[model samples]
Target chain A: MIGRLNHVAIAVPDLQAAAAQYQTTLGATVGPPQDEPDHGVTVVFIELPNTKIELLYPLGDDSPIRGFLDKNPSGGIHHMCFEVDDIIAARDHMKTQGARVLGTGEPKIGAHGKPVLFLHPKDFNGCLIELEQI
Target chain B: MIGRLNHVAIAVPDLQAAAAQYQTTLGATVGPPQDEPDHGVTVVFIELPNTKIELLYPLGDDSPIRGFLDKNPSGGIHHMCFEVDDIIAARDHMKTQGARVLGTGEPKIGAHGKPVLFLHPKDFNGCLIELEQI
Candidate 1:
Protein backbone atom coordinates (compact mmCIF):
# COMPACT_ATOMS: atom_id res chain seq x y z
CA MET A 1 0.00 0.00 0.00
CA ILE A 2 1.08 3.54 -0.69
CA GLY A 3 2.44 5.39 2.30
CA ARG A 4 3.77 8.89 1.68
CA LEU A 5 3.44 11.03 -1.38
CA ASN A 6 7.05 10.90 -2.57
CA HIS A 7 7.25 13.53 -5.26
CA VAL A 8 5.41 15.11 -8.16
CA ALA A 9 7.42 15.15 -11.40
CA ILE A 10 6.93 18.00 -13.82
CA ALA A 11 8.42 17.82 -17.29
CA VAL A 12 9.57 21.31 -18.24
CA PRO A 13 10.53 22.87 -21.57
CA ASP A 14 13.27 25.03 -20.03
CA LEU A 15 15.00 23.38 -17.06
CA GLN A 16 17.05 26.36 -15.92
CA ALA A 17 14.13 28.77 -16.13
CA ALA A 18 11.91 26.43 -14.17
CA ALA A 19 14.59 26.11 -11.51
CA ALA A 20 15.05 29.86 -11.38
CA GLN A 21 11.31 30.48 -11.07
CA TYR A 22 11.03 28.14 -8.14
CA GLN A 23 14.08 29.68 -6.50
CA THR A 24 13.59 33.41 -7.11
CA THR A 25 9.83 33.70 -7.60
CA LEU A 26 8.52 30.99 -5.29
CA GLY A 27 11.43 31.24 -2.83
CA ALA A 28 11.99 27.51 -2.60
CA THR A 29 15.26 25.68 -2.14
CA VAL A 30 16.24 24.02 -5.38
CA GLY A 31 18.93 21.40 -5.90
CA PRO A 32 21.34 21.12 -8.81
CA PRO A 33 20.36 19.16 -11.86
CA GLN A 34 21.55 15.58 -12.02
CA ASP A 35 21.48 13.75 -15.32
CA GLU A 36 20.13 10.22 -15.18
CA PRO A 37 20.96 8.81 -18.59
CA ASP A 38 19.19 5.56 -17.75
CA HIS A 39 15.98 7.42 -16.96
CA GLY A 40 16.64 9.76 -19.88
CA VAL A 41 16.04 12.87 -17.75
CA THR A 42 17.97 15.79 -16.34
CA VAL A 43 16.28 16.47 -12.98
CA VAL A 44 16.32 19.31 -10.46
CA PHE A 45 14.60 19.07 -7.11
CA ILE A 46 12.61 21.97 -5.59
CA GLU A 47 12.40 21.14 -1.92
CA LEU A 48 9.18 21.95 -0.07
CA PRO A 49 8.35 21.66 3.61
CA ASN A 50 6.46 18.38 3.24
CA THR A 51 7.42 17.08 -0.21
CA LYS A 52 9.48 17.73 -3.33
CA ILE A 53 8.72 19.05 -6.79
CA GLU A 54 10.93 17.44 -9.42
CA LEU A 55 11.66 19.37 -12.59
CA LEU A 56 12.44 16.96 -15.41
CA TYR A 57 13.91 17.72 -18.82
CA PRO A 58 14.63 15.39 -21.69
CA LEU A 59 18.21 14.15 -21.71
CA GLY A 60 19.15 12.47 -24.99
CA ASP A 61 17.45 11.55 -28.25
CA ASP A 62 15.61 8.61 -26.72
CA SER A 63 14.55 10.46 -23.60
CA PRO A 64 11.08 9.40 -22.44
CA ILE A 65 9.99 12.96 -21.69
CA ARG A 66 10.83 14.14 -25.24
CA GLY A 67 7.49 12.83 -26.47
CA PHE A 68 5.69 14.53 -23.59
CA LEU A 69 7.47 17.82 -24.32
CA ASP A 70 6.67 17.52 -28.04
CA LYS A 71 2.99 17.23 -27.20
CA ASN A 72 2.81 19.77 -24.37
CA PRO A 73 5.45 22.19 -25.76
CA SER A 74 5.18 24.29 -22.60
CA GLY A 75 5.46 21.23 -20.31
CA GLY A 76 3.23 19.82 -17.54
CA ILE A 77 3.00 17.42 -14.63
CA HIS A 78 4.41 14.12 -15.86
CA HIS A 79 3.70 11.79 -12.96
CA MET A 80 3.15 11.40 -9.21
CA CYS A 81 5.19 9.09 -7.01
CA PHE A 82 4.01 7.32 -3.85
CA GLU A 83 6.19 5.45 -1.41
CA VAL A 84 5.48 1.85 -0.55
CA ASP A 85 7.01 -0.28 2.16
CA ASP A 86 7.41 -3.49 0.16
CA ILE A 87 7.60 -2.99 -3.58
CA ILE A 88 7.25 -6.68 -4.53
CA ALA A 89 4.12 -7.02 -2.45
CA ALA A 90 2.78 -3.76 -3.80
CA ARG A 91 3.47 -4.82 -7.39
CA ASP A 92 1.76 -8.17 -6.83
CA HIS A 93 -1.25 -6.49 -5.28
CA MET A 94 -1.50 -4.08 -8.18
CA LYS A 95 -1.31 -7.00 -10.62
CA THR A 96 -4.00 -8.92 -8.73
CA GLN A 97 -6.19 -5.86 -8.93
CA GLY A 98 -5.77 -5.85 -12.75
CA ALA A 99 -3.40 -2.90 -12.87
CA ARG A 100 -0.68 -3.20 -15.51
CA VAL A 101 2.91 -2.64 -14.46
CA LEU A 102 4.88 -0.66 -17.01
CA GLY A 103 8.26 -1.68 -18.50
CA THR A 104 9.27 -5.33 -17.95
CA GLY A 105 6.93 -5.82 -14.99
CA GLU A 106 10.02 -5.72 -12.81
CA PRO A 107 11.07 -3.15 -10.28
CA LYS A 108 13.88 -0.90 -11.45
CA ILE A 109 16.30 1.21 -9.44
CA GLY A 110 14.70 4.63 -9.56
CA ALA A 111 15.97 8.21 -9.44
CA HIS A 112 16.57 7.96 -5.70
CA GLY A 113 18.35 4.61 -5.99
CA LYS A 114 15.26 2.92 -4.57
CA PRO A 115 13.26 0.09 -6.15
CA VAL A 116 10.38 1.59 -8.12
CA LEU A 117 7.54 0.38 -10.34
CA PHE A 118 5.28 2.31 -12.64
CA LEU A 119 1.60 1.50 -12.98
CA HIS A 120 -0.30 2.02 -16.20
CA PRO A 121 -1.95 5.43 -16.40
CA LYS A 122 -5.27 4.04 -17.60
CA ASP A 123 -5.72 2.12 -14.35
CA PHE A 124 -5.05 5.12 -12.13
CA ASN A 125 -7.57 7.84 -13.00
CA GLY A 126 -5.42 8.62 -16.07
CA CYS A 127 -2.59 9.67 -13.80
CA LEU A 128 0.82 8.06 -14.24
CA ILE A 129 1.84 6.67 -10.86
CA GLU A 130 5.32 5.67 -9.72
CA LEU A 131 5.55 3.39 -6.68
CA GLU A 132 8.87 3.83 -4.89
CA GLN A 133 10.10 1.68 -2.04
CA ILE A 134 11.02 3.72 1.01
CA MET B 1 7.03 32.60 -0.06
CA ILE B 2 5.77 29.08 -0.58
CA GLY B 3 5.79 26.92 2.51
CA ARG B 4 4.22 23.51 2.09
CA LEU B 5 2.77 21.75 -0.91
CA ASN B 6 -0.86 21.73 0.22
CA HIS B 7 -2.09 19.34 -2.44
CA VAL B 8 -1.91 18.20 -6.04
CA ALA B 9 -5.18 18.54 -7.95
CA ILE B 10 -6.15 16.05 -10.63
CA ALA B 11 -9.14 16.68 -12.86
CA VAL B 12 -10.97 13.44 -13.55
CA PRO B 13 -13.72 12.57 -16.03
CA ASP B 14 -15.41 10.20 -13.60
CA LEU B 15 -15.52 11.33 -9.99
CA GLN B 16 -16.75 8.11 -8.41
CA ALA B 17 -14.33 5.95 -10.38
CA ALA B 18 -11.40 8.17 -9.47
CA ALA B 19 -12.33 8.15 -5.80
CA ALA B 20 -12.71 4.35 -5.87
CA GLN B 21 -9.34 3.95 -7.54
CA TYR B 22 -7.63 5.98 -4.83
CA GLN B 23 -9.51 4.30 -2.03
CA THR B 24 -9.42 0.65 -3.12
CA THR B 25 -6.48 0.39 -5.46
CA LEU B 26 -4.07 2.82 -3.82
CA GLY B 27 -5.37 2.04 -0.31
CA ALA B 28 -5.65 5.71 0.46
CA THR B 29 -8.21 7.33 2.74
CA VAL B 30 -10.50 9.22 0.41
CA GLY B 31 -13.05 11.72 1.67
CA PRO B 32 -16.57 12.25 0.40
CA PRO B 33 -17.18 14.62 -2.46
CA GLN B 34 -17.88 18.25 -1.55
CA ASP B 35 -19.47 20.38 -4.25
CA GLU B 36 -18.33 24.00 -4.42
CA PRO B 37 -20.88 25.72 -6.64
CA ASP B 38 -19.07 29.04 -6.54
CA HIS B 39 -15.87 27.43 -7.76
CA GLY B 40 -17.74 25.15 -10.20
CA VAL B 41 -16.05 22.02 -8.87
CA THR B 42 -16.84 18.89 -6.89
CA VAL B 43 -13.81 17.67 -4.99
CA VAL B 44 -12.68 14.56 -3.15
CA PHE B 45 -9.54 14.42 -1.05
CA ILE B 46 -7.17 11.49 -0.72
CA GLU B 47 -5.13 11.81 2.43
CA LEU B 48 -1.46 10.94 2.15
CA PRO B 49 1.14 10.92 4.89
CA ASN B 50 2.90 13.99 3.60
CA THR B 51 0.12 15.89 1.82
CA LYS B 52 -3.25 15.51 0.12
CA ILE B 53 -4.29 14.60 -3.43
CA GLU B 54 -7.38 16.49 -4.63
CA LEU B 55 -9.58 14.82 -7.25
CA LEU B 56 -11.58 17.45 -9.14
CA TYR B 57 -14.73 16.88 -11.14
CA PRO B 58 -16.95 19.34 -12.98
CA LEU B 59 -19.79 20.49 -10.78
CA GLY B 60 -22.18 22.21 -13.17
CA ASP B 61 -22.50 23.99 -16.52
CA ASP B 62 -19.72 26.49 -15.85
CA SER B 63 -17.18 24.16 -14.27
CA PRO B 64 -13.58 25.38 -14.72
CA ILE B 65 -12.31 21.81 -15.12
CA ARG B 66 -14.77 21.15 -17.96
CA GLY B 67 -12.38 22.82 -20.38
CA PHE B 68 -9.50 20.67 -19.11
CA LEU B 69 -11.63 17.51 -19.34
CA ASP B 70 -12.62 18.39 -22.91
CA LYS B 71 -8.96 18.55 -23.95
CA ASN B 72 -7.91 15.36 -22.16
CA PRO B 73 -11.04 13.26 -21.87
CA SER B 74 -9.18 10.67 -19.86
CA GLY B 75 -8.29 13.41 -17.32
CA GLY B 76 -4.97 14.75 -15.98
CA ILE B 77 -3.20 16.86 -13.38
CA HIS B 78 -4.94 20.22 -13.11
CA HIS B 79 -2.80 22.17 -10.67
CA MET B 80 -0.46 22.14 -7.68
CA CYS B 81 -1.25 24.08 -4.48
CA PHE B 82 1.37 25.41 -2.12
CA GLU B 83 0.65 27.05 1.23
CA VAL B 84 2.04 30.43 2.18
CA ASP B 85 2.07 32.31 5.49
CA ASP B 86 0.98 35.60 3.96
CA ILE B 87 -1.08 35.36 0.77
CA ILE B 88 -1.16 39.14 0.02
CA ALA B 89 2.59 39.38 0.46
CA ALA B 90 3.02 36.29 -1.68
CA ARG B 91 0.76 37.76 -4.37
CA ASP B 92 2.66 41.05 -4.34
CA HIS B 93 6.01 39.27 -4.57
CA MET B 94 4.80 37.16 -7.51
CA LYS B 95 3.56 40.32 -9.25
CA THR B 96 6.90 42.06 -8.77
CA GLN B 97 8.63 39.06 -10.38
CA GLY B 98 6.43 39.40 -13.54
CA ALA B 99 4.18 36.46 -12.68
CA ARG B 100 0.55 37.16 -13.50
CA VAL B 101 -2.04 36.13 -10.96
CA LEU B 102 -5.21 34.73 -12.49
CA GLY B 103 -8.61 36.44 -12.06
CA THR B 104 -8.92 39.80 -10.24
CA GLY B 105 -5.45 39.47 -8.71
CA GLU B 106 -7.09 38.88 -5.34
CA PRO B 107 -7.03 35.81 -3.16
CA LYS B 108 -10.27 33.82 -3.31
CA ILE B 109 -11.58 31.45 -0.70
CA GLY B 110 -10.34 28.06 -1.82
CA ALA B 111 -12.02 24.69 -1.31
CA HIS B 112 -10.22 24.37 2.03
CA GLY B 113 -11.77 27.65 3.16
CA LYS B 114 -8.34 29.30 2.99
CA PRO B 115 -7.44 32.40 0.98
CA VAL B 116 -5.83 31.25 -2.28
CA LEU B 117 -4.64 32.75 -5.53
CA PHE B 118 -3.93 31.17 -8.91
CA LEU B 119 -0.95 32.02 -11.06
CA HIS B 120 -0.89 31.88 -14.85
CA PRO B 121 0.49 28.61 -16.22
CA LYS B 122 2.62 30.52 -18.73
CA ASP B 123 4.85 31.84 -15.95
CA PHE B 124 5.12 28.48 -14.18
CA ASN B 125 6.62 26.12 -16.72
CA GLY B 126 3.11 25.74 -18.17
CA CYS B 127 1.77 24.29 -14.95
CA LEU B 128 -1.10 25.96 -13.07
CA ILE B 129 -0.07 26.91 -9.55
CA GLU B 130 -2.33 27.76 -6.59
CA LEU B 131 -1.03 29.50 -3.50
CA GLU B 132 -3.04 29.22 -0.29
CA GLN B 133 -2.65 30.85 3.10
CA ILE B 134 -1.72 28.22 5.65
Candidate 2:
Protein backbone atom coordinates (compact mmCIF):
# COMPACT_ATOMS: atom_id res chain seq x y z
CA MET A 1 0.00 0.00 0.00
CA ILE A 2 1.19 3.53 -0.66
CA GLY A 3 2.21 5.27 2.55
CA ARG A 4 3.24 8.86 1.93
CA LEU A 5 3.04 11.19 -1.05
CA ASN A 6 6.74 11.30 -1.83
CA HIS A 7 6.96 14.15 -4.34
CA VAL A 8 5.40 15.54 -7.49
CA ALA A 9 7.82 15.81 -10.43
CA ILE A 10 7.22 18.59 -12.93
CA ALA A 11 9.11 18.55 -16.19
CA VAL A 12 10.00 22.15 -16.95
CA PRO A 13 11.61 23.76 -19.97
CA ASP A 14 13.37 26.29 -17.76
CA LEU A 15 14.31 24.84 -14.38
CA GLN A 16 15.77 28.05 -12.98
CA ALA A 17 12.65 30.09 -13.71
CA ALA A 18 10.47 27.41 -12.20
CA ALA A 19 12.62 27.23 -9.08
CA ALA A 20 12.70 31.02 -8.81
CA GLN A 21 8.93 31.22 -9.14
CA TYR A 22 8.50 28.98 -6.15
CA GLN A 23 11.26 30.68 -4.19
CA THR A 24 10.67 34.38 -4.83
CA THR A 25 7.07 34.45 -6.06
CA LEU A 26 5.54 31.72 -3.93
CA GLY A 27 8.12 32.29 -1.17
CA ALA A 28 8.89 28.61 -0.69
CA THR A 29 12.29 27.12 0.02
CA VAL A 30 13.91 26.02 -3.20
CA GLY A 31 17.04 23.91 -3.36
CA PRO A 32 19.83 24.01 -5.89
CA PRO A 33 19.74 21.84 -8.96
CA GLN A 34 21.20 18.35 -8.81
CA ASP A 35 21.93 16.38 -11.95
CA GLU A 36 21.23 12.67 -12.07
CA PRO A 37 22.99 11.14 -15.07
CA ASP A 38 21.36 7.79 -14.52
CA HIS A 39 17.93 9.38 -14.63
CA GLY A 40 18.97 11.74 -17.44
CA VAL A 41 17.50 14.73 -15.64
CA THR A 42 18.33 17.67 -13.39
CA VAL A 43 16.11 18.17 -10.36
CA VAL A 44 15.40 21.22 -8.23
CA PHE A 45 13.45 20.58 -5.06
CA ILE A 46 10.80 22.97 -3.69
CA GLU A 47 10.30 21.99 -0.10
CA LEU A 48 6.89 22.39 1.50
CA PRO A 49 5.72 21.66 4.99
CA ASN A 50 4.37 18.21 4.17
CA THR A 51 5.55 17.19 0.69
CA LYS A 52 7.99 18.28 -2.01
CA ILE A 53 7.78 19.53 -5.59
CA GLU A 54 10.57 18.47 -7.93
CA LEU A 55 11.34 20.60 -10.98
CA LEU A 56 12.81 18.28 -13.58
CA TYR A 57 14.79 19.39 -16.62
CA PRO A 58 16.40 17.34 -19.32
CA LEU A 59 20.03 16.56 -18.54
CA GLY A 60 21.46 14.33 -21.28
CA ASP A 61 20.56 13.79 -24.92
CA ASP A 62 18.46 10.78 -24.06
CA SER A 63 16.97 12.38 -21.01
CA PRO A 64 13.53 10.92 -20.22
CA ILE A 65 12.10 14.34 -19.51
CA ARG A 66 13.25 15.73 -22.87
CA GLY A 67 10.51 13.95 -24.79
CA PHE A 68 7.99 15.05 -22.17
CA LEU A 69 9.05 18.67 -22.57
CA ASP A 70 8.91 18.31 -26.33
CA LYS A 71 5.21 17.58 -26.10
CA ASN A 72 4.56 19.95 -23.22
CA PRO A 73 6.74 22.86 -24.26
CA SER A 74 6.06 25.09 -21.30
CA GLY A 75 6.30 22.22 -18.79
CA GLY A 76 3.92 19.90 -17.02
CA ILE A 77 3.49 17.54 -14.13
CA HIS A 78 5.49 14.53 -15.21
CA HIS A 79 4.67 12.11 -12.41
CA MET A 80 3.53 11.73 -8.83
CA CYS A 81 5.67 9.61 -6.51
CA PHE A 82 4.19 7.72 -3.60
CA GLU A 83 6.08 5.97 -0.85
CA VAL A 84 5.57 2.30 -0.21
CA ASP A 85 6.89 -0.02 2.47
CA ASP A 86 7.85 -2.86 0.12
CA ILE A 87 8.34 -2.07 -3.56
CA ILE A 88 8.55 -5.74 -4.49
CA ALA A 89 5.19 -6.37 -2.90
CA ALA A 90 3.81 -3.21 -4.42
CA ARG A 91 5.04 -4.16 -7.90
CA ASP A 92 3.63 -7.63 -7.51
CA HIS A 93 0.32 -6.26 -6.34
CA MET A 94 0.23 -3.81 -9.23
CA LYS A 95 1.01 -6.65 -11.64
CA THR A 96 -1.80 -8.81 -10.25
CA GLN A 97 -4.12 -5.84 -10.59
CA GLY A 98 -3.15 -5.52 -14.29
CA ALA A 99 -1.30 -2.24 -13.83
CA ARG A 100 1.67 -1.88 -16.18
CA VAL A 101 5.02 -0.93 -14.73
CA LEU A 102 7.04 1.43 -16.95
CA GLY A 103 10.48 -0.09 -17.15
CA THR A 104 11.51 -3.81 -16.83
CA GLY A 105 9.11 -4.18 -13.93
CA GLU A 106 12.06 -3.81 -11.61
CA PRO A 107 12.88 -1.09 -9.15
CA LYS A 108 15.65 1.30 -10.13
CA ILE A 109 17.61 3.78 -8.04
CA GLY A 110 15.66 7.00 -8.29
CA ALA A 111 17.08 10.51 -8.03
CA HIS A 112 16.72 10.34 -4.27
CA GLY A 113 18.83 7.15 -4.15
CA LYS A 114 15.81 5.00 -3.40
CA PRO A 115 14.30 2.09 -5.27
CA VAL A 116 11.48 3.41 -7.39
CA LEU A 117 9.21 2.09 -10.13
CA PHE A 118 6.94 4.03 -12.46
CA LEU A 119 3.46 2.85 -13.27
CA HIS A 120 1.84 3.45 -16.65
CA PRO A 121 -0.14 6.65 -16.94
CA LYS A 122 -2.92 4.92 -18.90
CA ASP A 123 -3.67 2.70 -15.96
CA PHE A 124 -3.89 5.61 -13.54
CA ASN A 125 -6.35 7.95 -15.26
CA GLY A 126 -3.52 9.28 -17.44
CA CYS A 127 -1.47 10.25 -14.43
CA LEU A 128 2.01 8.74 -14.15
CA ILE A 129 2.69 7.24 -10.73
CA GLU A 130 6.00 6.35 -9.13
CA LEU A 131 6.17 3.94 -6.20
CA GLU A 132 9.23 4.50 -4.06
CA GLN A 133 10.44 2.17 -1.33
CA ILE A 134 11.08 4.03 1.92
CA MET B 1 4.69 32.12 2.40
CA ILE B 2 3.28 28.80 1.34
CA GLY B 3 2.58 26.49 4.26
CA ARG B 4 1.42 22.91 3.75
CA LEU B 5 0.56 21.26 0.49
CA ASN B 6 -3.20 21.29 0.78
CA HIS B 7 -3.87 18.68 -1.88
CA VAL B 8 -3.19 17.55 -5.44
CA ALA B 9 -6.17 17.54 -7.75
CA ILE B 10 -6.47 14.96 -10.51
CA ALA B 11 -9.29 15.23 -13.01
CA VAL B 12 -10.62 11.82 -13.95
CA PRO B 13 -13.16 10.88 -16.60
CA ASP B 14 -14.93 8.30 -14.50
CA LEU B 15 -15.10 9.38 -10.86
CA GLN B 16 -16.19 6.02 -9.41
CA ALA B 17 -13.59 4.10 -11.37
CA ALA B 18 -10.85 6.45 -10.22
CA ALA B 19 -11.98 6.13 -6.64
CA ALA B 20 -12.04 2.33 -6.93
CA GLN B 21 -8.55 2.31 -8.42
CA TYR B 22 -7.15 4.19 -5.43
CA GLN B 23 -9.21 2.35 -2.83
CA THR B 24 -8.74 -1.23 -4.06
CA THR B 25 -5.79 -1.16 -6.43
CA LEU B 26 -3.54 1.14 -4.43
CA GLY B 27 -5.16 0.30 -1.07
CA ALA B 28 -5.55 3.93 -0.11
CA THR B 29 -8.28 5.25 2.16
CA VAL B 30 -10.64 7.09 -0.20
CA GLY B 31 -13.58 9.09 1.06
CA PRO B 32 -17.01 9.40 -0.49
CA PRO B 33 -17.54 11.86 -3.30
CA GLN B 34 -18.72 15.37 -2.42
CA ASP B 35 -20.47 17.37 -5.14
CA GLU B 36 -19.32 20.98 -5.10
CA PRO B 37 -21.93 22.76 -7.19
CA ASP B 38 -20.20 26.08 -6.99
CA HIS B 39 -16.96 24.64 -8.32
CA GLY B 40 -18.80 22.32 -10.72
CA VAL B 41 -16.76 19.39 -9.48
CA THR B 42 -17.52 16.17 -7.64
CA VAL B 43 -14.46 15.37 -5.59
CA VAL B 44 -13.26 12.17 -3.93
CA PHE B 45 -10.60 12.57 -1.28
CA ILE B 46 -7.76 10.05 -1.25
CA GLU B 47 -6.08 10.40 2.11
CA LEU B 48 -2.32 9.94 2.25
CA PRO B 49 0.09 10.15 5.18
CA ASN B 50 1.47 13.61 4.54
CA THR B 51 -1.18 15.12 2.27
CA LYS B 52 -4.26 14.25 0.22
CA ILE B 53 -5.13 13.56 -3.43
CA GLU B 54 -8.41 14.88 -4.77
CA LEU B 55 -10.03 13.02 -7.66
CA LEU B 56 -12.16 15.54 -9.57
CA TYR B 57 -15.03 14.88 -11.95
CA PRO B 58 -17.29 17.20 -13.85
CA LEU B 59 -20.44 17.91 -11.89
CA GLY B 60 -22.29 20.45 -14.02
CA ASP B 61 -22.72 21.34 -17.69
CA ASP B 62 -20.34 24.27 -17.25
CA SER B 63 -17.78 22.26 -15.34
CA PRO B 64 -14.28 23.69 -15.72
CA ILE B 65 -12.80 20.18 -15.87
CA ARG B 66 -14.80 19.43 -19.00
CA GLY B 67 -12.34 21.39 -21.15
CA PHE B 68 -9.35 19.57 -19.62
CA LEU B 69 -10.99 16.16 -20.07
CA ASP B 70 -11.86 17.12 -23.62
CA LYS B 71 -8.19 17.62 -24.33
CA ASN B 72 -7.02 14.67 -22.21
CA PRO B 73 -9.75 12.08 -22.45
CA SER B 74 -8.05 9.77 -19.98
CA GLY B 75 -7.92 12.57 -17.38
CA GLY B 76 -4.83 14.14 -15.87
CA ILE B 77 -3.35 16.14 -13.04
CA HIS B 78 -5.46 19.28 -12.69
CA HIS B 79 -3.79 21.46 -10.07
CA MET B 80 -1.71 21.48 -6.91
CA CYS B 81 -2.95 23.32 -3.82
CA PHE B 82 -0.64 25.01 -1.31
CA GLU B 83 -1.76 26.59 1.94
CA VAL B 84 -0.82 30.11 2.92
CA ASP B 85 -1.33 32.03 6.17
CA ASP B 86 -2.72 35.13 4.46
CA ILE B 87 -4.37 34.87 1.04
CA ILE B 88 -4.47 38.64 0.44
CA ALA B 89 -0.79 39.07 1.16
CA ALA B 90 0.11 36.15 -1.04
CA ARG B 91 -2.00 37.60 -3.87
CA ASP B 92 -0.42 41.02 -3.57
CA HIS B 93 3.05 39.52 -3.51
CA MET B 94 2.29 37.44 -6.58
CA LYS B 95 0.93 40.51 -8.40
CA THR B 96 3.91 42.64 -7.45
CA GLN B 97 6.21 39.91 -8.71
CA GLY B 98 4.39 39.97 -12.10
CA ALA B 99 2.65 36.65 -11.66
CA ARG B 100 -0.87 36.73 -13.08
CA VAL B 101 -3.76 35.47 -10.98
CA LEU B 102 -6.69 33.71 -12.62
CA GLY B 103 -10.32 34.95 -12.63
CA THR B 104 -10.98 38.31 -11.06
CA GLY B 105 -7.82 38.05 -8.94
CA GLU B 106 -10.04 37.61 -5.91
CA PRO B 107 -10.11 34.76 -3.43
CA LYS B 108 -13.11 32.51 -3.76
CA ILE B 109 -14.47 29.88 -1.38
CA GLY B 110 -12.72 26.68 -2.43
CA ALA B 111 -14.12 23.19 -2.05
CA HIS B 112 -12.50 22.89 1.37
CA GLY B 113 -14.53 25.89 2.55
CA LYS B 114 -11.47 28.16 2.61
CA PRO B 115 -10.51 31.26 0.68
CA VAL B 116 -8.58 30.05 -2.38
CA LEU B 117 -7.09 31.71 -5.43
CA PHE B 118 -5.82 30.10 -8.60
CA LEU B 119 -2.60 31.30 -10.19
CA HIS B 120 -2.03 31.32 -13.93
CA PRO B 121 -0.41 28.12 -15.09
CA LYS B 122 1.62 30.01 -17.70
CA ASP B 123 3.46 31.84 -14.90
CA PHE B 124 4.16 28.60 -13.04
CA ASN B 125 5.64 26.50 -15.84
CA GLY B 126 2.31 25.17 -17.08
CA CYS B 127 1.34 23.91 -13.64
CA LEU B 128 -1.88 25.31 -12.18
CA ILE B 129 -1.38 26.43 -8.61
CA GLU B 130 -4.14 26.96 -6.05
CA LEU B 131 -3.31 28.87 -2.90
CA GLU B 132 -5.61 28.34 0.06
CA GLN B 133 -5.74 30.40 3.23
CA ILE B 134 -5.19 28.16 6.21
Tens digit per residue, CA lDDT, model 2, A1-134: 89999899999998888888889999999999998999899999989989999999999899998888989999999999999999999999888988999979889998899999999999999999999999
Q: Local error of candidate 2 at B65, Å?
A: 0.5
Query: For candidate 1, lDDT tens digit of each residue in B34-120?
Result: 999999999999999999999999998999999999988999899999999999999999899999999999888988899999999
Candidates in order: C-alpha RMSD to true structure: 0.9, 0.7
Q: Clashes per prediction?
A: 0, 0
Local accuracy of candidate 2 as per-residue lDDT tens digits, B1-134: 99899899999999999999998889899999999999999999999999999999999899999999999999999999999999999999999999999999999999989999999998888999999999
Clashing pairs in 1: none
Clashing pairs for model 2 are none
* TM-scores of chain B, in order: 0.98, 0.99
The alpha-carbon lDDT assigned to residue B16 of candidate 2 equals 98
lDDT of 2 at B112: 89
